[model samples]
Target: MAALIVAAGRGLRAGGDLPKQYRALAGRPVLAQALTPFLADAAIDHVMVVIGPGDNARYAHAVADLPTGKLLSPAQGGATRQDSVRLGLQALAATGFDGIVLVHDAARPFVTAALMRRTVDALQSEIAAIPALPVTDTIKRLGSDGRVAETPPRDTLVSVQTPQGFHFKALLAAHEAAVAAGLSGFTDDAALMEWAGHPVKTFPGDPANVKLTHPQDFDRSQGAPLHVRVATGYDVHAFGDGDHVWLGGTRIAHDRGVVAHSDGDVALHALTDALLGALTEGDIGTHFPPSDPQWKDAASAQFLAFAAERVRQRGGRIDFLDLTIVCEAPKIGPHREAIRAAIAAAAAIRIDQVAIKATTSERMGFTGRGEGLAALATATIRLPEPE
Candidate 1:
């Protein structure tokens, strides 16, 4: 069976120059996230997209990193959503497709493999099937006079979502028939099918399968991780015989350097570990072993950059990076802003997202004796919900 994602809509309401599907959700494009589960599902034989007229380049960029073994060339969509569905169906038919087609919305990036399976399983017995959630709030039908015309039974009211499953040939024929009869404005494929005398069955739908629309939707999505990860890391580097020390990617004049394989920015190292920890990845040494000569005397800035990239690669993002320095010889208060800016530059995040603070050990520990510097860091990150 094939899956067709409808992404033709130009969502100006989402408040960006790019189409909502091409806009970044975390670090990846919205369409890319929507396409991920379908691409990984074993049951989906082929996947297609119905795109807007000038969205070729955007769509191409969105799916560039994805394994497109099951993807078909996109079909240009029509003005209306109903028209776009018909075009996608017709395109599939032209390729001799007679199997079930699951029509999905690109805005609903959280569609899961299990939901797709549920829709397809229902299609085994029914020609038309859709995923729907029961409505909790009372729905009102407004009349022409601006009064509530009817109070629909809350139990019977359901909010529908896609990918809506259908028998490919049957839905395509229904579209042609609707056009031949000069039908217009059918809200969805199921509604069109109902007009053509086909009953549409409903199955349980996921509450998280949300359609992103308003600008606030994107704002709210910032905290939409299945897991809000807060990980902490601490690093202590003893002072060796050198003239300068690296702290938070900034070189500070010191009596001695750090005893480490790299330049040993303690703050950067601790922050890197925090980022990796939040991602459940191994520590800094686990990725860049000290035994590797290539990393010897390397800039710790690169280490932090690598960690940041790993988060993006996982379709996750760092929410905050907090660092604390424990030292006595060099006053951290004097270089706090510089440290924050340096860390932000290395991580490619705003300075506001990076927090740098400092404290001493009150002449108690090795830090108080000015033997070495220590850093403590906390990274907060968000990863998309698992499929």
Candidate 2:
């Protein structure tokens, strides 16, 4: 299955200088938070986003540090939300996608894995399915004359939310038909399905999946101060017969290489472990085993990226990554800033958030003897305090 995230709206009502999806929620962009679960989900095969024109820069910055291997090129959006959905569906169809597609709202970033599972599972027996919460308040309908007109029973009412799941071809055809018929007032895709004579099933919705709209929704106090976690990681690689070495995503000229299953980037390996430690996830070996033949020559930058995505998956952000490289050769003085930039790009944080230092072991340790290189890294992160 695939997902199409609708983030094309101006969202000025959210009171941010940028679009609400590009604005910060917790410590990362709202759209990043919204995209994390879907990207991390095993059931989803592809994810695409619809963006407004002139939002290219904002969109790039929003998902800059995320693991987006499955993300397709963003589709340009039209004027209204309905038009954006139709265009997004059309774009997906152009890719020859005919499987189920989940249409989600960018404003609702709290979408959970379980909620997505429920939505997807409901589609097995229905042409269309949506998540909805039962209404509990009294209903009212007033006359245009400013008088009480009628009150309907609240039992029949429900508030709907995305991601609304549907057969891609079915929904695309319905949208085309609606456009041909000059239908313009439908509030959601579900309503359009109703107009096209498709029966839409309802699944239970999550109340915590509220949309962030008002300015106060981004207030730190409303969500409480995040939990601060500090963790350390260390890695060492012995010199072997090679002409180059990889460190922090950079390939440098060297007389020898490190013995390892992967590219043997000690800096990124240590940083990846430090971030996993901060998230209390296992070390690099746990996620990527040395015994795995597929990772025999993989780049370490992707390892760092995977670890960083785990933090985002848990609703946290990396604050700082401080690394100290211990070596007697390769002279770290010149590449300090380059190493920092590479680490920052892999970990999805600003360069200022990364710190790199170098030292020699006073000509006593193995590092001082020039047999190998070692890296020590400490990762600091902020996560929503567990309730």
Candidate 3:
């Protein structure tokens, strides 16, 4: 079966510089997190992501490390979520895909492998199957005057989630019919299928698979109490013969470059170590040893990304990162924003959450003598209390 991740929506309600799907959650883009399980699953043959117009570059960066063979080139999506889903289906149809398709939202990064399996398993007997959790709280119907008009039976109500499983051809046809009939605001794919006279069955949904809709939803404290950790890192590189240096994943012209096994990005290296320290994981060298030939002249961004992923694997979120670069050459003021953006992208956090500053060593130390550069970084992260 193929999986289509709907990531086209702007998600203004989530309130970030980037769309919610592209926004970072636990040191990785929400879209990346949503795609990981599907890409890793042996049962899923192909995976496609539907994205908003002009988001190709951002999408590419988000999935940079993923296996390219399983991914289809991103399809541009329309103004609405429904439109995006229909367009994705058409794209899949054009590729001669006619098997089962699972539709999911990129904002629900917590969707698990087990939930996906349950949805797929249900399709064995039904044309459409979705996961839903029984409504536990009493629901009330409101009147025009704002008073509760009726109390609905909670036992019959359920909160639905995706990846919703469906026979590809049937779902594609249902979407086409809706467009032809001018149906505009049906929220989910299952609702459209129901409108097309197909029976939709519900399997158990995971409560942990929460959709990120509002700004507060991104706040770990808003959902559950968490434990916060802070760690600091410092790194320095001596001047070498090269004409330029790599700093925070960006190349800057300088009289001399740093001598190191990797790209020698002092800022990124420090940030990576800080993240590892916060996670109680060993330093960067512990994971990517300098003795390994594969890491020779490697970009420091990869080191930072590795550390960030470790934090996510432990179910933690990076709350803030601050780095100060000490250098005598190649002033950092002009590139401060670029460095912040680069670090944020690498660490999978918001740009606002990262801070970059520059300083001099008062002409006393190696940095002041124009011999090399140094960087100090502090990382703050939050994780769920240990069970």
Candidate 4:
């Protein structure tokens, strides 16, 4: 079966140059997060994305790290949500897959493997299948005055989500008919099929597979409380006049630099935060204190390698890392790629798995005064669930 992911929404509600699907949630793009399970499944043949016209660059930036062998080029989306869905259906029509087609929203990133498999099963028995959860709250209709008009029966109400599956041909025909009839009020594909006289089956939905509509949604992540850990490190060196400064793994030619016990790589220091977070260890300072004198001038890479080896020894794997560098003088853009490479190399992971970014304190703090560079990082690791 094939899948078409509708990620074309401008995400006006999420409010950013980056759409909601492209937003970072748990250190990964929301769209890439949604696509992972489908790509890993053996039954899925290919996947396509419906995106805004002239935003191929945005799509490219969002999916740069994903293996593109299974991805189709972005199909041009329309002004309305329905238009985007219709366009996605049209694109898949050309691929000529007679098997079932799964339509999913790029904004929903928490879909699970079991739910995805069940969606496919529903398609085998019914022309269209949707995943939904019975509404739990007592929903009420509100009038212009902002008072409840009437209470809707909760038992009959359900909240729906995508990866909505269908017999490939039937879905295509329904979309074509909807467009031809000028009936565009339908908010989802299942509704369109219903209006076209097609019966859509329903399956259970994981509450965690939420659609990210605003920034706050990211702050509330659900699922197995990802084995979370935090580590902090601190390095202080005397100020000295020098031509080169190293922060997080980026090098800048400057007039003065922090004299350190090692390279004074602030980027690595922040990465240690995430690594520690994953390992549930303390910060960099806890592991390597300045009073020890043994680590003076130690290469921060040594600290990172040691941490990684320790994590492996404990039977865990690092999934991704987010590192941010803060400094005053030497701009960061020129060295971003190099910094990414350095972290990935130290972690023994792909460069794409490491995100390196830079920011300034707006000259407000010590870093703003150009005293020294600072970094903050968050890391994710996966360990076997307890037996």
Candidate 5:
């Protein structure tokens, strides 16, 4: 099978300097996200991306790092998405792949690998297969007076999405037929295939696989393809008489101790806050209240670890952590790498993703007076969509 990703649309509906497909969602381009599943599939022989003439330089820059073996950029596109698709199909047909053609929209970033596979399977028996989600809302036809003219049966209604699959040869013939018939108003490839007398089967579609048609749509779906967030934190503990102090899960003897009910590991506290902030959950206090006796003198690192694991179990991934320690005494430079490693191990992420920095208070405040130590941390996590 091969793929033709229609990205040449002017996106006038989306309205932006860059076409909707080239815009950034999360940290990657929308088209990139949309193409990932197909690129990963061994069955997809190649992928042709059709772009507008003026977008050539930008398209190259946008997809410069994508795999070249199965990806291609054909000549500049015509005025409509259907024209762009036809151009892409001609390029694919030239490549001699007549197995199946999967036509996808570059604006639908949330199309999952599973959905693509399902569509491919359906194409094995039918001339064409389109992902169509069952509509859950009431159906109505409005009159010129803004009244309901006819109520269609909701049971038979379905909202179609892509990557709509078709036999490569059949799809090409269908498009050519449509062109010959002077029909250019197809909202999707399946409809065109149906018009050409090819049976198109329906496969399950993801509700979250939404196309970005307007500015608000992009805003709603932009971000890591996963539904995750990043947050940061910082805290300080003053020095006072105490038996021992905790630092990144290690006990250390100190002249003065941080004043807190817990071990007063300011670094861990800040990081905890950051993690909770990312989850949009309440702060550490809400989870482990100071009012609770069982938490008194409890390890703050433990609390942070629990929060990290909670997000992990929720199908989320922490991408990075940046921790900074500030104090004049109990020098932090020696423990930087060790602390970073420890944090990474606890957060279940790579060492490179975790950073630890140290700075002196410059003798300017309570920390400068050597009364306490302070630490701040930032956490970046990738949260997958809820099942």
Candidate 6:
């Protein structure tokens, strides 16, 4: 089955510089957290995300490391949530998807695989299935006047959550009918399905699946404590006969290059070692042996990616990476920003979290003699405390 994640809303209520879905949560974007489970689920065939116009850059940064084979290009969203969902359904129809579809909210990042399975399983015997949590608080109805009109039984009221499942064709047809009928205010996919005369069945919802709508919702002090670690790395390479040198994943025109089995990106290599050191996972050479013929001329970016993945596998995140290149021949100031961006992309972290600097050896060493280059790196990372 396919999954559509709605993330186009402005999310003003969250009160942040970016949309709530793009906001950081537990060191990762909320949308990224929400998309991981569906992407990892073997049952899901394809996943589509709908975003606001001009949000392509933000979306790209958010989903950089995710698997993309089953991820479709984002669909442009409309004015209202209802309209955005309709446009998503239309995009699916264009792709000729007629199987079950799960519509999810990007703000609710805590959704679990079990809940997703339950929703899809419920759809096996029902036309539409929505996950809902029975209300435990007293329910009241208010009148136009500032007075309570009536109090309803709390046991009869339920709060709805998402990844609402439905037959793609039926939901698409219902959305089209609503548009033709000039209807525009339905809040969720299940409501539209109900309006179209489809029976909406309720399945149990997880209480942990709370939607983030305010700044306070991002406070992690109420949750688990994170352990921080710092590690440093240093690498040196002698100048070879090549006309260009690779540093921090950026190739620079130089009078000479470094002698190494790989691309010899000194900056990235040091940073990778720093990350591996932080995890106590040994050095880059331990993972990618210099003797391996298959890794000959391999991009240093792959090594950095591998180290970053190890951090993620341990439920850790790179907080900051600082790298300094020491050389005298090729000027680094000209390519500093590009190098920073390249490293950030390779490490799958934000650009601001990465710092790149360059300095000369004062013409006192191998770098000053124009014979080689050296780089130093320090990485700070946070990981969940071992139980």
What is the per-residue lDDT of model 2 for residues 102-207, given as tens digits with 9 covering 90 to 100?
A: 9999998878777888999999999999999999888788999978898888988999999999998899999999999998777689999999999999999988
Q: What is the lDDT of residue 49 in candidate 5?
A: 81
Q: Per-residue lDDT tens digits of candidate 1, residues 183-209?
A: 878878989889989999999998868
Off by over 4 Å in 1: 224-387
Q: For residues 107-226, what per-residue lDDT tens digits would candidate 4 score against the true structure?
A: 987665567788998877799999999998999999999999999899999999988999888888888888898878788999999999999899998776788887667776532344
TM-score computed on alpha carbons, candidate 4: 0.60
Better of 1 and 6 by lDDT: 6
**What TM-score does structure 1 among the candidates reach?**
0.61
TM-score (all chains, Cα) for each model: 0.61, 0.64, 0.61, 0.60, 0.60, 0.61
Clash total of candidate 4: 15
Clashes of each: 0, 0, 0, 15, 7, 0
Error of 2 at 385 (Å): 5.3
Cα displacement (angstroms), candidate 5, residue 320, comes to: 8.1
- State the lDDT of candidate 3 residue by residue for 106-213, as single tens digits: 999987667888999999999999999999899999999999999998998999998999999999999999999999788999999999999999999988789999
Every candidate's lDDT: 0.86, 0.87, 0.88, 0.75, 0.77, 0.88
Pick out the ten consecutive residues of candidate 3 with the lowest summed lDDT: 217-226
For model 5, how does the per-residue alpha-carbon lDDT over 1-387 read when each residue is reduced to its tens digit?
788888888777887888888888666677776765566455677878888888877787666645555676555677887888888888877766678888888888776656778998897788899999998999899999999999999999999998999888888888898999899988888888888887889988988788999988877664345754878887877777876677775566667677898988887888888898888888898899989999999977668776776675454656777888888878776677666655654553445777788888789988788778888888888786655
Clash pairs (backbone) in predicted model 2: none
Candidate RMSDs in Å, in order, are 13.7, 6.5, 10.4, 14.5, 13.0, 9.6
Model 6 scores worst on lDDT over the 10 consecutive residues at: 217-226
Better structure of 2 and 4 per TM-score: 2
